[model samples]
Target chain A: MKRFTRSLGLTACAFLALCGQTQAADDIPTIRVGWSIPAEEMKYWMMRRPDAFPDLGKQYRIAWTQFQGTAPMVQAMLSDAIDCSSQAPLSLGQGAASGGLQAYVLAQHVGERKGESFSVYWAVAEDSPVRSVADLKGRTVGVNVYGSGVYGQMAMILKQNGLDPERDIRLVETGFPGSEAALRAGRVDAAVMNQPFALRAESKGGIRKLFSLTDLMPNTVHIFEVCRKDFTDAHPELVKRYVKDLRTAMALAREDRAETLKVVSEVTRAPVDLLDGYLLTDKDFARSADARPDFEAIQQMLDQYQQLGMLPAKVDVAQFRRDDLIQ
Target chain B: MSAQAILQRLGAPLTVLVLLTLWELAARALALDGFPTATESLAQLPAILFDGQSLQSIGASLARMFAGIGLALLVAVPAGLAMGRNPTLARMLNPLLSAAYPVPKAALMPMVMLWFGVGDLSKILVIFLGVSLPLLYHSYHGAARLDDKLLWSAAAMGMRAPARLLRITLPGALPEVLLGCRVGLAMALIVMISSEMIARQSGAGDLLFNALDMALYPDVYAMIVILAALGFALDWAFEHLRLRLVHWAEPRQDAASGGNS
Candidate 1:
């Protein structure tokens, strides 16, 4: 009887020790970050490097998560499953305004540049007679998602060409990689594509560029990094460290083409040649690593979305910016 | 076979052909770019079926569907049997089952992904959830509604409990179980396709979705055709299997409709 009692006591003590250990582990400052696939999110690639962001890792354990698109990523943020994520500006704004998610834009991940650099392109089959946006009347076009940045750009472009996006033509939602095949097969008159898919499709040589994001709205922000407002308020230091780590990684990626290509190739599983064609140039990096959100550009997107009835009302772009965290 | 009987058998095929003709005419008349005529979609089917990528996608989707339905059967059948036999177990599970039955399985997808990751396991779980409820309900009803005369006869014959359950109760329940399996199988395919479209790296759903993204309208139609053929073939196979296993049971009128009794 005494032996059984002693064993039970010992088991109880051991269970308590385990509980305490778990509590300590839980207290170790962890942040879950979400990213979309195919776009080659820089922080995820940088995290692969053993020597990169040493201090950040030491300060906090980074839990990285992958998502298929901005909508899912935004869903994760709303559910408190992820503290931060990268999303298209239109997605972030629409999600914030509609879902009532307290999210702040931290930095621009991809944006439009004048004639030198741009991320999104509208492309059609080379054999097709459709020369311009005017030719797209009563035809089908493709976007990655209905409420995504690509869709916004397509809508804006259609409007610019005196076409109503709703009644003028049909817009189908297609993934970036799939858009290339659809364009080739004549499934759509044009597909709204983003880098490195646009670059890859161009290299294949049967698709013609119908228009670019810059063609419609020059020097605009397309995609940006965002974090939940409550998370930033509660863990300001961790958020700052994350931003610092990201900036350092972006700078490193910009300076070392070979290293960046190696990491991107590893993450995306694309060939080095494709990565070289897409990433190894000043013009490419210019659009990719802009560390600050252009408020004017963001406002332009907001106004455009509102005008198109995509957003319920105009949201103040400045209110969503977290320049302090980025700095 | 009599001439009238043969003509009656051709009704389904004739209706299908008529629908296809209408569809082809409508597509041509509308002249909608990217909307393929039935002929265009059918012509592309051979190439799509032969493509390595498409074949792999079909295989992956089928594998997930079978695995999910198999898993659902493994758990649901036994649990359902136990619940139907014991009033206490039925009371415990019926409320919970009914509560969950009406909830959209897709809504649970995000939570499932959080738990299982965006992999085959998550998609399988979604399909499993979708299939298991109808299976459980059918199984419970099958066991619970067993003829009292048969049970009384088995008891009077001095047959043991296990033997009676195996020989009489289970065989009697086979028709309902098979009916549940058929419904579950169809649900499994639908849930699998939706989950794949949302969370997949590859599958028939991904193939269809990607094809649409690239604006490959004929490929999209071809995928739809393949999915329809797959569902029809599987349903036919299940019906044959059911007729074989439950040969003693009265032929159900609703069997042709594939509808629940």
Candidate 2:
């Protein structure tokens, strides 16, 4: 009877030891993510909520930082201040072509589709005489920035309409909110707007959409998730887990609209009505949260940028894409 | 001028040249990818200067800067003079000025835009707000602290208040007022550039920002050079005007120092 008791005690001790080992293995470090204030990248914001992805919080802590644009985001990623971020294809291409950054695609932020996707719009005052892209000649136009995705789309659309982006129209770099203000004030003939701002401008009833990016280039990839090559190499499993958590958050957002809207309103500090105007349609959620990198679309964007003389040389899109991470 | 004076005059330009040379060398040694060498930027200068759009941008920026400073002077000089001559006005305005001086003028940009709309007026008002404070302060002190002996003599000579102000007070205060104008001019340029960068369809700041966004490093550097040259030329012109206007006042050793000296 004494031997039986000793054997039971040893079994209990072994079980406790196994439990402690498992707990130690489950411990997760904090991951820093840089994002902008846009609905497309709000998945990261939603994941921060307690009920959004409980398992994600259990596995890892997230630290979120907001940046104004992808240029500064690239700077942060290069300096190792951020583990990952969302970047426009033009910015990613510029960084890669300049040899300043090497990053792997993790997911898509916005995708282009025929007659469905909402990307960027060229807008004018409601009473303006400008009706089409051809009317842009001798008129001042506004872009978020010159090397940004909006600027690239503006150039492409103007070029397609037989207008030279450089000579035919005066392209001024007016920021997003400022662009709308500039348009209303008659400062610029047209201003490029995206996402919530585009919808907000439309609902405000003063600005008219001159054209959209979809009108010129269909099936174009607008923005993507990127992590430094070194970060991915060091924390391969962490990257996978982060992508999985992001995917889960995306799914939850689509599955539960009311909760997603509440989170979006809180994260953006925008009014619910404005968000409703922005989120009323699936076409508004044209941003794909897919983990797999869209290689064909990315290649097409790279080719366009190369043709525009924005990239120094053509880059191999495959070299920057890591499909295995998502797999 | 003596050879030492010549060397002293050349000191600033020489320092700039050395720094630029070091920048070029460092860029080459480090193989900096996006940054352009000083020489490369210099090579792009003619292109920028010859570009019609760039020239128009420079003109627009200069015009805005001058217009802002001009408006500030129109209001601040008279108000400062009145406050200096009248203690009642001084007591009323002094607290307001003291309170508003420390507030960053850039923080008022959104409010100014809402009031004035996002046109040249908003930018001009921002510059005006930034510059008027320094000008008002200096002008008030300049006119307030007139030599009592000069005023007494003018009064004794039967000079009325208007003539006394015209001859004695104005001449006595010219030096300080010119100093204010010089400082205000610099402030106006700085504010103009910053406001233009924030919201503008055309200006040197806008050109610089657009170039940076396009990754035109050489063009960006070239724009900086142009802006620096423009600022220097304006400062030199103001200094010349100050010397000519306030010839009786003792010249300070440092030409670049502001009104506090």
Interface RMSD of every predicted model, in angstroms: 6.2, 16.2
**In model 1, where do residues sit more than 4 Å from their true spots?**
A1-24, A125-131, A172-174, A280-290, B1-75, B82-128, B141-147, B153-261
Top TM-score hit: 1
Minimum summed lDDT over a 10-residue window in model 1 chain B is located at B207-216
Looking at model 2 chain A, report the run of 10 residues with the lowest lDDT sum. Answer: A39-48
Q: Candidate 2's residue-wise lDDT over A1-327, tens digit each?
A: 999999999999999999998777567666667676565534544544655666566677666654546775675566566778888787888888885689898877667677776767788888899998898899999998777766776787889999998899887888775666678767899988866666656766877888887786677776678888998888888888888877776666666677777776555434466567657364474655454567788887888788888888897788787877877
Q: Name the runs in model 2 displaced over 4 angstroms.
A: A1-27, A45-47, A280-285, A289-291, B1-261
lDDT of 1 by residue, A72-182 (tens): 877777767678888876677777888887887886666667767755788888888889898899999988777766687778888889988889998787767577767
Error of 1 at B148 (Å): 3.1
lDDT of 2 by residue, B1-261 (tens): 999999999999999899999989987875442467889889989977887867887898888888888899888877887677778999999999999999878778656754664457878889889889988988789889987788888799899988876777767777887888888887887787777644454577756765554345677788788878877998998898888877768756566376555
Query: What is the overall TM-score of model 1 with all chains considered together?
Result: 0.66
**What lDDT score is found at residue B161 in candidate 2?**
89
Candidate 1 C-alpha error for residue B106, in Å = 4.4
- lDDT for B178 (candidate 2): 82
TM-score of each: 0.66, 0.52
lDDT of each: 0.77, 0.75
